[model samples]
Target chain A: MDTTSYNNPEQGNQEERLWNYIDGTATATEKTLIEKLIESNAEWKEKYRELLEVNQLLQASELEAPSMRFSKNVMEEISRVHIAPATKSYINKKIIWGLGFFFITMFIGFLIYGIGQMTFTGGEESTLTKNISKVDFSKFFNNTWVNAFMMINVVVGLFLLDMFLSNKRKEFRKQA
Target chain B: MSTGLNDNEIISKVLSGDHQAYAIIVNRYQNYVFTLTLRMIKSREDAEEVAQDVFIKAYKYLADFRGASKFTTWLYTIVNNTCITFLRKKRLDIQSLDNEHVFATADNIDSGMRANIVEQKSKLAMVNDAIGLLGSDDAQIITLFYKAEQSLEEIAEILGLETNTAKVRLHRARTRLKEKMETHYTEEVKNIYN
Candidate 1:
C-alpha cells in the first residue's frame, strides 16, 4: 500500500490480485493463493487491510442529495417539452415489410420475364443492333401491365428526384 | 414521494398518457443522477441543470426504453452522455493536459460544503473528496460501481466499454482513489481511524 512504489511492476501485479480477490472475481485457485499470501506474508496482509478499508469506505459512501425542489423543477421543464410517443405507435413494421416485399417481387418478376423473352440466335453474325431492332416495340408497349409499370416507375423516379433536390436545398440553406 | 410503485409500472402509466407519473421516477433517481452528474461536471449549478435535462430527455425518449435492461442502467447511460456533452460544450479539455484543472473545479464547489458537514472529517467526506480529485472517467467508473452498485456488465453498457474493460477501469479507479486518500487526506484518515 506504499504510494511511492505504485509504479513498481510488482506492486501493480499485487494490487491487481488484491482487487480481483476483493471483487470476488478471482478463480478458486487465485482465491486460495491470495488467502495463503495474506495469511503468511506481512506485506500482503497490510495491503489487504488497506484495500479492505477502501472497499468499506466506498460501500458506506452515501448518494449525494440535490436541492429540495429538484423534482419539481424537472417536472416543470417536462411540461414545456414534447414527449416522444412509443415506437410502435408511429412506425408500422408490417407496412414497411409489405413495401419491401412488393419491390423485391417486382424485381424478380421483371428478371424472369426478361430472361423468358431472350431469343438466343447462335449465329456468328449476331450483333446488338440487329437483336434490338427485331424486338417489336409496339407489341411490348401494347401490354397494359407494362404501360402501368412504366407509369409507376416514372412517378417514383420523379418523387425520388424531388426529394433529393429538396434535401440539397436544405443543406444549402444550412450552409448559407 | 416514495410511490410504492415499481419503475416499469410508472413507465407504463406515463406512456399511457399520465405524465405526472414521471415525477415518481424523477424522485426515485434524482439523488443518484445528481451525484453522478456532479462528479463529472464539478459545478453544482451546471450539474443541476444537466441533471434536469437528463430527466427531460429520458422522459421524451421513455417510449424507446424496452425493458431489456434495468431502468437505472438506461437512465445512467443518459446521465453519462449528457454530462459528457455538457463538458464538451463548455470546451473543458477532458482529453489531456488541462484535465486535472477541469476536474479540480470540484474542490471549489465541495470544499465549503465538506467543511460544514462535520467538524471532524468523516470517512465519507474524505472518500467524496478523493473521488472529486479523480478525472471524469475514473470518477464516473467509481461512482457507477460503488455508489450505483452497478455490475461490471451494466457499467460496460453505460460507458460503452467491454465488460473486461470496465472491470480494469474500476480496479484502476479504486487504486487511484486509495492513492488519493493516502496522499491528500492522510491526517484526516488517521484521525478518523484513531
Candidate 2:
C-alpha cells in the first residue's frame, strides 16, 4: 500500500485515510487537509477526537515488569546451551560453489579425455552399449523381493522426510 | 565483539565466545520482554518462564539473528512467540472477559500517586482497565506500539502484517480501547454521582 500518498477523500468514505492521518502516516498535504477537515466538519472532528482518545489510552498503560531474578534465570539457562563457533556456524557458499565448479570441470575434462581414447569393445558398439548388452533384466523383474525392498526404502525415506518436515513446521510455528 | 557495546555488538561478543556478554543483553531487554510476555500470558509466573525462555532462545540463536531488524524488535518477536507457544502448550489463554492483567498493573501503580497524583492515578487506572479489556492481539499491539516505542513499519514486520494492515489493526484496536475507557469511566462517574 502506497500509504505515504496524500489521500483526499472524494466523498463520505475516508475512514481508512482518516485512520492513516491519525496514525501520523499521512503525507504533509493529507495532514493539512485532515486538520482542516477536522476543524470544519463536526463528524470528522468527533471521529478524530475518538481516535485521539483511544490513541492516548492505548499509549497510557505499561505492562508489568517481571521480578528482579528474570535475567538471572535466563542467564542460567543460556549457560547450558552449546553455542557453535562463528566460523563453523555459517556455511561458506563460496566453498560449495567452488567444489561444484571443480567437480563439473573434472567431469568435462575426463569426458573429453575418455572420448579421445575411446575404442569400441564390439564392432560399431560403444562401451556403454556393450555393457548394457551383457546385463540380464529378466531375473531382477522376476523377483518380487527386490521390488519390495525398493518400495520399503522409498516408504521409509518418505516417512523420514515427513517427520523432518513436520518437526520443522512445528519449530516455524513456535517461532512465529 | 567489544565487551561494552551495543546490542548487535554484544550479540557478536556472545557469538564469539564472550558468553558473559549475553548478561548485558538479558539485563537490558528483560523488563521489556517481560512486560510483553506478561501482557500476553496474563500471569506473572508464566510470563516469567516465557521471558526467560525468550533470552535463552535469543542466546542459543544469536548467530542466526540476521540483524536485518533492530535487536529489540528481534527480541520482542521472540518474546511474543514464546508467549504464544507457552499459551498453546498450557491451554490457559481463555479470554474469560476478565481484567486481571489490567488491575494487576493498576494495583502496582500510584500507591505513591499521592494526593495530587490521585486524579492522575484514576485516569491511568481507567485507561489501564480499558487496555485490559482488549483482546490479546490488540493489547499486544498497544504495548508494542506505545510502550516498546516501535514504529508502525517495525510493528508490521514484527507481527507479520502488511503496513496498511497493521495501521488498520492499530486504528481499530485504539477505537476499541477508547470505547472500553469511555464506558468504564462513565460508569464510574455515574456511581460517584449516585
Task: Identify the candidate with maximal TM-score.
Answer: 1
Best by lDDT: 1
Q: Residue-wise lDDT of candidate 2 within B1-194, one digit each (tens)? A: 24368888877777778899988887777777877776687667877887888888877777778776788888888877787778788886544335655556756776656334535556557666566677778878888898888988778878877667887787666655655554545544333223
* Alpha-carbon local distance difference test for all models: 0.83, 0.69
DockQ of each: 0.43, 0.22
Candidate 1 falls in which docking quality class?
acceptable
Q: Which candidate is the best by DockQ?
A: 1
Model 2 bad stretches (over 4 Å): A1-16, A84-176, B1-4, B92-121, B187-194
In candidate 2, which residue pairs clash? B110-B113
Error of 1 at B113 (Å): 15
All candidates' TM-scores? 0.72, 0.63
Docking class of 2: incorrect
